[model samples]
Target chain A: MRVLGIDPGLTRCGVGVVDGAVGRTLTLVAAGAVRTPADEELPARLLGVEQGIEQWLDDYRPDAVAVERVFAQHNVRTVMGTAQAGAIAVVCAARRGLPVALHTPSEVKAAITGSGRADKAQVGAMVARILRLDGPPRPADAADAVALAICHLWRGSAQAHLARARQEFARRIETARQAHGL
Target chain B: MRVLGIDPGLTRCGVGVVDGAVGRTLTLVAAGAVRTPADEELPARLLGVEQGIEQWLDDYRPDAVAVERVFAQHNVRTVMGTAQAGAIAVVCAARRGLPVALHTPSEVKAAITGSGRADKAQVGAMVARILRLDGPPRPADAADAVALAICHLWRGSAQAHLARARQEFARRIETARQAHGL
Candidate 1:
């Protein structure tokens, strides 16, 4: 399955695409960011974000989307920006009929660097090593996007397994109920 | 001066332009909304918002922009949409070199209805009365935008007065210090 991961922001958004089956190796397809001029009006900037996402969707066409969950903090401005970015990601995925999943920062870090508290530099270094890149992803947002994608790839398989188990259990229970003639 | 008031949202954004001066009457110049398909990709919707705002800016060329300030809320999804809308408005104003002011919901309601706790219908009715319109502004969001603009006009003048007072006070203090040689 091809999965697209996004780190959303009003001024700058980082995106990464990966392709692989559950419990198997995944390959990076493409990655980039959509940035708008800080001086531009809100509507124009929103258009830039829309145009950028459309371009990526058409080019990559990933099967699923993964985004980072917004965390509450003291900085109202920062929180607001993060929330906007998250909404944009959700709307984009919903429009495309792609299932979207949200992962926490710590979950992404743990999946990538074997530690939930791993710093950005550490996560970036690990991503570089795993993806076997020449250097770290520029602009921490981009690296984080990649890490988020990897986390989904790992956790998604486990989730799928649990879902299958639940289905099997339900089927057995139904069979037992029928046998009891109740 | 012409002031454009914007009520930002994910699916639809309401925009209203009004003509006013420091002491002159305010008149509605134009009002409308920019909407996007909910099923489209987030990026595409953002592009629509950008283009819509650009078209409005080109057509109206308002003197200033007034937008609602987003406060923290419990619903993550709702807050996300609000933040995105707010960011787009800010970016739009900044791009055109138009001064932008933000007002809280309570402030706008108080300005229009003489009470901050006024409901949407109440606020809309008051806005229509204040502007002497034949009917209320349809699609509550549009009326809200107009009310927000009115609030800015009133509060903006008050702010100007306060600023002048501060300047005069500072000047008096400087003159006194100089005369006393302290």
Candidate 2:
């Protein structure tokens, strides 16, 4: 399945699409950033972000979307903008009826580099190697987005399968209980 | 002018519509909360917020919207959710082409109670008094939302006039400069 990962921000939002499936090699379909001017009003900037993500979703048509979940940070202003951007991305995907996943920074690092504590360089190196790129993706945000897509592709499939299994198991248990009339 | 104030949150998004202009008695047209269960997924919750805000906009048809500006907090998760909700409210207003304003907590408090550090009880009390209600609005979120609307109605008109004057002044200056060929 193809996955679109978004590293959401107001001034710059990173987007990367990856074509992959469970236990298969992943390929980079596209990588870029959506940017709004710092001087613009908040509402306009937000609308720009929403429109940008919607366009990307329409163009790439990824099976799923992965967004970097906002976490508490020392910089409240930055975190608020990131969270806003991330939320807009999720809304855009949901409006299109596409499945969305949120991956924390550590989670993306762990999935991409096998270490929750991996540094940015390590994650970038791993993403480059996995995607078979000669050099790391330009603009750290874009690389981070690629890493997010790769992480989602690698981890989300397993999680979805597990969820399905659990649901099926619950269904069978309910059916058995009904048959027994207990 | 009519103002729709939003107290943005993930679980309970408070909305209040107040009708009045500057130097006039404000009336609370509607006050309530748009609720989303905490048990729901993030995307679904975000969608709920979007839909809720859209419904309010459609129902009230307010001339302007005021959202509480989220600040960095000790609790990062709560702040993130609040910021996301606030952003969605802004987007909803912008989509409807209504002017949007963001009032900080301190600003709202000061506008309502004459003190930036006024307690919630003081703010709620003031809201009841301003709206000429016998008792405080139910749910602190709803009261706070009313305060947001009141604040915007009192402060936003002056700001809007100033903005328009500035725009007109700039236009005149450009015209004069062009005429002078300097």
Q: Largest lDDT belongs to which candidate? A: 2
* Model 1 TM: 0.63
Q: After TM-score superposition, what is the CA distance of residue A32 in candidate 2 from its true location, in Å?
A: 0.2
- Write down the RMSD of candidate 2 (Cα, Å): 5.6
Query: Which digits, one per residue and each the tens of the lDDT, describe model 2 over residues B2-85?
Result: 899999999999899999975678899999999999999989999999999999988999998999988786477788889888
Q: Write the per-residue lDDT of candidate 2 for residues A42-156, one digit (tens) a residue.
A: 9999999998998998899999999998878647778888989999999999888899999999999999888999999999899999999987687788899999999898887
Which residue ranges in model 2 land beyond 4 Å of their true spot?
A160-182, B158-182
TM-score of chain A of each: 0.86, 0.86
The residue-level lDDT of candidate 2 at A17 comes to 92
Q: Provide the TM-score, chain A, model 2.
A: 0.86
lDDT of 1 at A173: 94
Candidate 1 CAPRI-style tier: incorrect
